[model samples]
Target: MPAAGSGLYVGLMSGTSLDGIDAVLVDFSSGTPRLAASHHVPFADPVRAEALALCAPGADEIDRAARLSNALAQLYAEAVAATLARAGVPAAEVEAIGCHGQTVRHRPDAGYSVQLVNAALLAELAGVRVVADFRSRDLAAGGQGAPLVPAFHAAVFRDAREHRVVVNLGGIANVTDLPPLGTVRGFDTGPANILLDAWAARHLGEPFDRAGRWAASGSADEPLLCEMLADPYFAARPPKSTGRERFDLAWLERHGVATRRPQDVQATLAELTARTVAEAIARECPGAAAVCVCGGGARNDDLMARLARLAAPVKVTSTAALGVDPEWVEAMAFAWLARQALLGRPGNLPEATGARGPRVLGAIYPA
Candidate 1:
C-alpha cells in the first residue's frame, strides 16, 4: 500500500437497512479529497434475508455468522474491484480499502459493535490493504462507538461563517452538529429508512417507498405518531446510537401498528423520522443556519417535505449543494477514515462518540 496522504482509497459501506454495498474510490492526492469513481452492488435476496436474520439471535448462530462473514467479504471484494475498474485505478496504487462491513448487531452499551467482514480475506481478494472494524476501539474507550461520520463531516462540511448540521438518513438517522466554533457533536436521531423500507416491502411489494409516495398518499396517525415519539431512544441524551435491535418490524407491532391502516402507518413512520430529526436539530443544534441531508432518506420527497416544514427558518437541502452527492457521502467518509488510519491519526471525534479521548480506529490487513 502507498503512504496515506496522497493516493486512491476505496470505501465500502452496507448499513443497517440491509441495503447493498456502496463503494467509492476517493483521490486524496490534492489537498482536498475528490471522488474518482463510485459503484453499488445490490444484495441478492437470500443474502439480505440471512443478514436480517442474523441481526437477532437465532439457532446455529455461530456457524451461520461465520459463513455469512466469508460471503460478505467476497461481496466486498467484488465491490472494490468494480469501483477500481470504474475509476481506472490500479489496485497497487490504492493505499487501502476501508470496509465498514455488515453490522449484524451494534450493542455499544455492552462494549461491542459487530461488523462482519473477513478483513484478511478482503485484502487478499482485492489485492490491497484493508481497514475494517472501525468501531471496536471507540467502544473500548467507553464511547458509544457510532456516529463516527461526524469527524468526517466536520472535516469536509464545516464552514467558519455558518453553523451547519449534517444529517445522514440511512437505516437509522444521525445528526452531526458543526458549529461555526465549538466541539462537534453527533448521535442517532432515530429510525430512518429501515422501518419505512420494511413496511413498504410488506405492503407495497417493493424494496422501498420510492419518494415516500405511499406515505404521501396517507395521513399520519397523530396518536400513533405521538406514542412512537415517546420511545426513550428519541428522548435520550446524546453520545448514543441504536439499530434494528431497537427499531424493527417487531417494534412497530408492539405499538399496535397493525391496527392502523398500512398507508397510515407508513405515513406515521415517515412523520416519526421527520419529527425526531427536526426535534434533535432543534434541541442539540440550536442556531444552526442550514441542515445538509445525505443518504437514502434524502431521496424521499415525502420525508424531505415534512422535515422542511418542521425545520422552517432553517434551510433544508441535500449535501449536493455542498458539493457531495448525498448517496455517496458515507462511503466517501469511510475512504477518508482509511486514510486517517493509514496515517496513524485519530478518526473518532471524542465529543461525538464520548470516548475517553481521540482514538485511531480500525485494524489493517495487509495486501
Candidate 2:
C-alpha cells in the first residue's frame, strides 16, 4: 500500500457542541488499520466560549477564528501526545494525523463546508504529517460530504445476521442503517445535543444537563414538540445534512416556543431529538432489527427513554454492547477514515451520503 512508508496515525475531532476534543491513535498494518488507543481532552473554558461564539454568523469574526484555529491545532497536538503516551507509543512511530477539525460551517450543497483546523500548525506542533479538511473534496464532487463516518461504521460495526441502525447523537443526530449483508444508507435526522446543551448553558449555567436530569425534572410541552417536528428537514429524503447554521441558538430562539419554565423547554428539546430520529428510522429503515445508539446523546437517559418509546419493536442498545465505546465512536471512525485514505479505498457509501459514486476520501500530507 503506497510503498510502505505509511505507519501509524492519529485522528482528532471537535464537533459542533464545543464539548471536547476526541483523539484516536490508528496503526495501519497489512492494508487495514487497527485502533491503538483513544483519549478525550476537554476544552478550556475561554477556548470553548470563543469556539461557540464563532459558530454563529457575524461580521469581523475571521481574526478571532484564525486565532482559535491555531489554538485548536495546538490542543489537538497535545491530545495526540497524551493518547500516544497512554498507549506507550512515541510520535515518531506514527505516520500522520487525520484531524476532522471543528466544523464551524457545513453547507455541502453550496459546494463548500469549512472545518476550522490548521493542519500546517498541527503538523508543526505534533511533528507528524497531518491530513485535515476531509469534507470539501466530496462536496466538490457534488456529495453531501457528511455522515462520513458510515464508511468506517460499516467497516467496524456491520453485522452479517442482523440488519442494524447506528445512530450518532452528537450536536446533530445522524443515522447509518446497514442492511443485513448488503448496502448501507444514512442521513442527518435532526438536532441532538446542540439544542439541549445550548439551552442548558443559557438556563442553568452549565454546559449540559447531565444524564438529562433537568429534562427529567420537567414535563414535555406537546404543542412545542409538535411544531418542531413539523420542520421540513425531518420529512425530506436521505443523503441530506445540516449543522448549527440551521439549528442553532438563533434558529431555536425564533422557532422554539417561549416558555416560563426552562426545564419544560429542555424536556421538549430532548423529545424533539428522539421523535425525529425515531421517525427517520420508521420511515427509512422499517426492517432494522436493532438500533445501536452512540455519541454524547446516548448518555442522556431522558433522550434514550423517549427514543425507546418512539421506535418500538426495534431493540435499542448502546454501541458499547457492540464493542465500541459510545463516546469514542465518532473519533474512532475518523481513525478508520485515515486508514481508508492510505489504502486508496472509497470512504463514502453512495447510498448513505448521496455521493455520485464511491470516492476515496481525504488527502495525504507528508511528515
How much lDDT does each candidate structure score? Answer: 0.93, 0.84
- Stretches > 4 Å off in candidate 1: 1-6
Worst lDDT run of 10 residues, candidate 2, spans 1-10
Q: TM-score per candidate, in order?
A: 0.99, 0.95
lDDT of 2 by residue, 1-367 (tens): 2234556768788898789999988776655456679899999899888887777777778898898889998899899999999899877777667789888778777888888878888888888777777786677678898989888877777888889999999999999988876678889998999999999998899999999999999888887787778888989998899998889887777764564478998998998999899989999987899999999999999999999888887889999999778888888777767766767887788787677888878766666
TM-score of 1: 0.99
User: How many clashing residue pairs are found in candidate 2?
Assistant: 0
